[model samples]
Target chain A: MAERIALIDYGAGNLRSVHNALLAAGAGDVAVTDSADIVRAADRIVLPGVGAFGACMSGLSALPGMIAALDEAVCRKNRPFLGICVGMQLMVDSSEEHGSHKGLGWIDGTVRPLAPSDPQCKVPHMGWNDVIPRGAPPLLEQGEAYFLHGYAVESDDGADILATTDHGGPVAAAIGRETMIGVQFHPEKSQRYGLALLERFLKWRP
Target chain B: MTLRTRIIPCLDVRDGRVVKGINFVDLADAGDPVEQARVYDTAQADELCFLDITASHEGRETMIDIVERAAAVCFMPLTVGGGVGSPDDARKLLLAGADKVAVNSAAVARPELIRDMAQRFGSQCVVGSIDARAKNGGWEIFTHGGRRNTGIDAVAHAELLASLGAGELLVTSMDRDGTKDGYDLDLIRTIADRVTVPVVASGGVGSLDHLVAGVIEGHASAVLAASIFHFGTHSIAEARAKLAENGIPVRRN
Candidate 1:
C-alpha cells in the first residue's frame, strides 16, 4: 500500500498548490485534511504555511487537538515531516514578527527579522536564492529555490542547520533532525528543483 | 550570491484568455493563459504575472478561474493584478492560488487598501503597481493605462506604498512603454533607492540588454516584459544568458 501523506490545512498556506506539487512528485495517497485523526494516521506529513508567523500560528492553534496530533505523529510516531516557508518558521521556539509569538518549538530556534548587512538586500528576500546543503541534510540538495519571506529561523544548534542561503549573510534555508525537516523556500514554487526535493522527501526512508 | 535578478513575462489576461493590445486597442488573442503559463514555467521563467485587463466586472470571475487553473500546473510564483480595488478582491485572487496581488489605481485612490491587504495577507503578498509618465521635472503617476494623470509624484508615491506595507513595487514607464527605448532607469532608481522592498521594472524591454539594465542600471530587483517573450523576440534562457553575461546573477531557469 502507498503511504498516506497528510497535508495539514489550518486555514493558512497554499493548500492546493502544495497538494498538486506532491501529486506531481509521485505521491499516490496525499490527503489535504484539517482533521487530527487523519494526521495521526498518515504515514507522512506536510505542513505548509504563508503570511505572517503570528497569524499562521493562531490559525493552526485554532483547530482543537491539531497540534497535539501533530506532536504525536511527528515526535512520538516518528513519521517523516516537512514544512514550507512560514510553516518552517513555525517549528522554531518563538517569532519576533508582530510581537513575540510562540511556535511549535519542534526545532531549537527562534524566528528573527532578516536584517542583511548589505543595504541592497531587500526585505521579504523575495525571488530565487541558492540552497547550500550542510552536513548532508536529508531531502535537501544544493540548488536554488523560490523564497518569499521577511523573517527567518535562527537555530540554537548548528547541527540542525540542514541548509543555508545567502542574502546579505547566511540565512537558514532548511533545517531538520531525524525524521523532521523544514524548508524556508516554497517547493511548489521552486520549479524542477522544488519538485525534485519533494520527490526526495516522498522517497526518503528517514 | 544574493537573490537572483528575476525575469518575469507578463500576460495581459481578459475574460479568461490571454490578450495583448497596443495602446489598449486592437486586442489579439495570444492563447489560453494557463497554457501560456505552462510554457513559461517549462521555459524556466522565474515568475509569472497575470494582469486581469477585463474591462467588465462580470469578467473578474473568469480571471479568478484562469488563475486557479494556471496555478495548478505552473510551479513558479504567480502575481495577479488588474481590478484589485479592495482587500476582499485581493483575498479572492490569493485564495484562488495567486501568491501576490498587484494593486494600481486602487492603491492610488485609497492608499489604505495596501495596508489593509498587507495586514490581512502579510506584506509579502501585496504588490503596489505604479504607472508613471515623465512630467515637468520628475515623473507623475498615471492611471487608466496612462490615459489619466493623477498629479502625484512617482518617487513619493513609491515611497508611500512601500511604507504602507507593499512587499514589492512594480513600476511601469508610460513614456517608454511602447517605444522599445528601454526602461526608465532614472525613474526606477529614484524609487528603488527610496524603498527597501524589491522593485520590478516594467513597460519597455526591447532586447536582453534592457533586462540587465533594469537590474544594474535601474537598480530593479526584477524585470517584466510582455511582447519580448510573448512574441518570440527572445527566449527566457536567452534573457538569463544576457543578464549573466552582464554580471547580473540570474536563476538558471
Candidate 2:
C-alpha cells in the first residue's frame, strides 16, 4: 500500500500551496482533509497555517474530532507529524498574540513576538533567512530556508528544537521528538531548498 | 552575519505577457506570465515583482486571474503593483494570493492611501514604489510610468511614505534605468537612510559586483533588475554565488 499523508485543512489559511508542494515533491498519496477517520488511518500528518496564533487555535479547537484524531495519530500511532508556520507554533503550549491562546501543547514552550530592539530588523521577518541545524536530521541538513512570521515558539525543552534562525535573537525553526516534527518556515514556499527539505520529511523513517 | 543582497526579476505585464524597455517601451513580448513565472521559480530567484503596467490605463480590473494563476504555479511570495490605488485594490490582490501590493503614483498623489491600505491589511502588505529621476542636482519623483515629474524630493518622499505606514520602499532610479551601467548607489543611500522599512534598490544593475555594492555600500535591503536576467545575461545561481563569495549571505539553491 502507498504511504498515506493527511494534510489537515482547518480553513484558517492556504491549503492549496502546501498540497501542491507535497504533490510536486513526489508525495504519491497526499490527501487534504479534515475528516477524523482519514487522518487516523494516514501514515503521516501535516498541519499548515498562515495567520495570527489566536485565530489558528480557534479554528483547530472548533474541529474537536480532527484534533483528537491528530493527537491519537501522533501520540498513539507515533506516525510522523509536521507543522508549518503558525501550525508549528500551535505545537507549543500558548502564544502571546491576541491574548494568551492555548496551543495543542504537543511541545513544551510559549510563543512570543519577535524582539523590537533592532530598528533595522523588520517585523513579520518576511523573506529568506538562514537556518542553523542543531541535530543531524536529514530534513534540516540543508542550510537555510525562507521565513515569514511575526511570532515564534521559544522552547525550554531544547531537545525538541532541531534548528535555529537568528533575527534579534536565535529563534526555533524546526522542532520534534520521535514522530512529531514542526517547522516554523513554510517549506512549501521556500523554493528548491524548501522542496528538498519537504522531500526529506516525506522520506524520513522514524 | 552580512545580509544577502537579493537578486529580483521584475516582470512588467501588459495584458498577460511580460514586456520591457526604458520607461515601459520597446515592448518585446515575452512568454505567458505563468510560464515565465515558472522559469524564474525554477531559477531560484531571490524574489519576484510583477507590475500590471497597463491595468489602470486600460480601464480593466486588476489582473487578479493572472495573479492567482501565477501563485498556483510558483510558491515564492509575489509582489504585485500597478493600478493599486485603494485599500480595496490591495485587499483584492492579497486575497488573490499576492504577498504584497506596491503603490506608486497613487500613494504619492494621496499619501494617506498608504496608511489606509496598511491599516486595512497590514504594514507588511504595503510597499511604496517610487520612480526617481535626477533634477537640479537632486532626485525628483516621477509618476505614471516616469512620464510625469512630481517635483518632490525622492529622499523626503521616501521618509514620508515610511512614516505614513509603508512597510517597504521600491525605489527605482529612472535616469539609470535600462542603462546597465550600475545601480545608483548615491540614490540608494539617500533613501535607505530615510526609511525605517526595507528599501529595495532598483534600476541599472549590470553586474554581480553592482548588486553587491548596492547592498554593502548603499545599504539596500534588496536589489531588483531587469534586461540582465530577462535577456539571459546572468543566471540567478551565478549571481547568488558571486554575492556569497563577496561575503553576502544569499540563500543558495
Candidate 3:
C-alpha cells in the first residue's frame, strides 16, 4: 500500500500547491484534511504553513484533538514528519511576531524575526536563497529553495541544526531530530531542486 | 548568497485566458493562464502574477477555477489579482490555492482595503499593486488599466500602502508599459526607497539588462515582464544568467 501521508490543513498554508507538489514528487494517497483520525492513521505526516507564527499557531490550536493527534503520530509513533516554513517555526518554543506567542515547544526553540545586517536583505526574505546542509539528515540535500518568511526558528540544541542559509549570517534553514524534519524554504516552490528534495523526502525510510 | 532578484512573468487574464492589450485596447489572445503558468513553472519562474484585468468592466469570479487548476499543476507561489473586492473573495481564491492576492484599483479606491485584507490574511499575503504614470516631479497613481488617474503621488501611495500593512508592492509604470524601452528606474527607486516592503517593478522590460537595472538601479527586489517571456524573446534561464553576469545575485540551477 502507498504511504498515507496526512497533510494537516488547519486553514493555513498553500495546501493545494503542497498537495500538487507531493503528487509531482511521486507520492500517492496524500490527504489534505483537518481530521485527527486521518492524521493519526497516516504513515507519514506533513504540516505545511504559510503566514505569521502566532496566526498559524492559533489556527492549529483552534482545532481540537489535532495537536494531540500530531503528538501521537509524530512524537510518540515517530512517523516520518516534515514541517515547512511557518510549519517549521510552529515546532519551536514561542514567537516574537505581532506579540510574544507560544509554539508547540516540541523542539525547545524560539521563533524570532530575521534581522539582516544588510539593508538590502529585505524582510519577508521574499525570494530564492541557498540551502546549505550542515549535518546529515535522511534525504536532506543542499540547494536553493524558494523562501517567503520574516521569522525563523532558533533551536536550543545547536546539534538539531540540519541546514543553514545565509540571510545576513547563518540562518536556520532546516532542522531535524529523530524522524522529524523542518525546512525554512518552500521545497514545493523550488522547481527541479525542490522537486528533487520532495522526491527524496517521499522515498526517505526514516 | 542572499535572496536572488526574482524574474516574474505577468499574465493578465480575462475569462481564464491570458490576454495582452495595447494601452488597454486591442486585446490579443496570448494563451491559457494555466498552461502558461505550467510553462513558467517548468522554466522555474521565481513567482507568477495572474492579474484579472476585466474587474471594473465585468463583474465575475472566473479566477477561482483558474487559480485552482494552475495551482494544482504548478508549485511556485502564485498571486491572483483583479475582482478581489472583499476578504471573502480573497479567501475564495486562497482556498482554491492562491498564495497571495494582489489588490489594485480597488485598493486605490479605498486604501483601507489594504489594512482590511492584511488583518484578515497575514500582511505577507496582501500585495498592494499601484499603476503609475510620470507626472510633474513625481508620479501619478492610475487605475482601471491605466485609464483612470487618481492624481495621487506614487511614492506617497507606496509608503501609505506599506504603512497600511502591504508586505509587498507591485509598482507598474504606465508611461513605460509595453514600450519595451526599460523600467522607470527613478520611479521605481523613489517608491522602493520610500517604502520598506519589497517592490516588484513592472512595465518596460525590453531585455535582460532591463531586469538587472530594475534590481541594481531601481532597487526593485523583483522585475516582472510579460511580452518578453511570453513571446519567446528570452527564457527565464537566460534572464537569471544575465543578472548573475552583471554581479547581481540570482538563483541558479
Candidate 4:
C-alpha cells in the first residue's frame, strides 16, 4: 500500500499549492485534512504555513487536539515530518515576531527577524537563493530554491543545522534532527529543485 | 550564491484568458495564462505575475479559476493584481494560490488597504504597485492603466507604502510602458532606494539588455515585462544568460 501523507490545513495560506506540488512530486495518496485523527493515522506529515508566525501558530492551535496529534505522530511515532517557511519557524522553541510566541519547540531555536549583516542585502530575502547543505541532511541538497520571508530559524544546536543559505551572512536554510526536517525556502515554489527535494522527501526514511 | 535577481513575466488576464497590450491598451489575444505560466516555469523564469484586467463581477470568478489552474501546473511564485480592492479580494487570490497580491489604484485611494493587507496576511504577500509618470521635474502616481494622474508624488507614495508594511514594491513607469524603450531606470532606482523592501521594475523592457540595466542601473531586486515575453522577442534562457553575462546573479537552469 502507498504511504498516506497528511497535509495539515489550518486556514493557513498556500495549502492548495502545497497539495498540488506534493501530487506533482509523485505522492500516491495525500490527504488535505484538519482532523487530528487523520494526522495521527498518516504515514507522513507535511506542515505548510504562510503569514505571521503568531497568527499561523494560533490558527494551528485553534484546531483542537491538532498540536497533540502532531506531537504524537512525529515525536512518539517517529514518522517523517517536513515543515515549510513559517511551518519550519514553528519548529523552533519560540518566535520574536509580533511579540514572543511559543512554538512547537521540536528544535531548540527562536524565529527572529532576518537581519542580514550587509544592509544592501535587503529584507524578506525575496527571490531565489542557494541551499548550501551542511554535511548531509538527506532531504536537503545543494540547489537554488525560492525563498520569501522576513523571519528565519536560529537553531540553538549548531549540530541541528542541516543547511545554510547566504543573505548577507550564513543563514539557516534547513534544520532537522532525526526524522523531522524543516526548510525556510518554499519547495512548492522552488520549481525543479523543489520538486526534486519533495521527491527525496517522499522517499526519506529518516 | 547570493539572492539571484528575479525576472518575472507579467500575464494580463481578461475573462480567464491571457491578453497582451501596449501601454495597457490595444489589447490582443495571447494564450492561456496557465499554459504560458507552465512555459515560464519550464524555462526557469524566476516568478510570474498575473494582472487580472477583467472588470466584470463574473469575470472575477474566471480569473480565480485561471489562477487555481496556473498554480497547479506552475510551482514558481505567482503574483496577481488588477482590481484588488479589499482584504477579501486579496484573500480570494491567495486562497486561489497566488503567492502575492499587487494593489495599485485601490491602494492609492486608500493607503490603509496596504496596512490591512500587510497586517492580516503578512507583508510578504502584500505588494504595493506604484504606477508613475514624469511630471514637471518629478514623477507622479497615475491610475486607471496609467491614464489618471493622482497628482501624488511617486517617491512619497512609495515611502508611505513601505512604511505601511508593504513587503515589496512593483514600480512601473507609465511614460515607458509598452514603448519598447526600456525601464525608467531613474524612477526604479528612486523608489528602490527609498524602500528597503525588494522592488520589481516593470514597464518598457524590449530586450535582454534592458533587463540587465534594470538591475545594474535601476537597482531593482526583480525586473518584470509583458511584451518581451508574450511576443517571444526573447526567451527566458537568453535573458538569464544576458544578465549572467553582465555580472548580475541569475539562477542558472
True contacts kept of each: 0.75, 0.23, 0.70, 0.80
Recovered share of real interface contacts in candidate 2: 0.23
Task: Determine the backbone clash count of candidate 3.
Answer: 1
lDDT by residue (A114-206, candidate 3, tens digit) is: 888888777767888888887566767777888888778876667788888888887898887888888888888777888898888888777
After TM-score superposition, the amount by which residue A75's alpha carbon in candidate 2 deviates from its true location, in angstroms, is: 3.8
The superposed Cα distance between candidate 1 and the true structure at residue B175, in angstroms, equals 1.0
Q: Is 2 or 3 the stronger prediction by lDDT?
A: 3
Superposed on the true interface residues, model 2 gives a C-alpha RMSD in angstroms of 2.7
Indicate the TM-score of model 2. 0.84
lDDT by residue (tens digit), candidate 1, A1-206: 99999999998888888988999999999989999999999999999998999999999999889999999989998999999999999987899998999999888898999999999999989999999999777888888999999999996667788899999999999988889999999999999999999999999898
The model with the greater TM-score, 2 or 3, is 3
lDDT of 3 by residue, B124-237 (tens): 788999889988878999977788888998888889999998989999999999999999999999888887779999999899889999988999999999888877788889
Segments in model 3 whose C-alpha atoms lie over 4 Å from true places:
B21-30, B56-60
Clash totals for all candidate models: 0, 0, 1, 0
Runs in model 4 lying further than 4 Å from the true structure: B21-30
lDDT per residue for candidate 4 within A2-46, as digits (tens), equals: 999999999885998999999999999999999999999999999
Give the DockQ of candidate 2. Answer: 0.32
Task: Single out the weakest 10-residue window by summed lDDT for candidate 3 chain B.
Answer: B21-30
**Which regions of candidate 1 deviate over 4 angstroms?**
B21-30
Error of 3 at B229 (Å): 1.5
| Candidate 4 reference-contact recovery | 0.80
Question: For model 4, how does the per-residue alpha-carbon lDDT over B68-187 read when each residue is reduced to its tens digit?
Answer: 999999999999999999999999999999999999999899999999999899999999999999997999999988999989999999999999989999999999998999999999
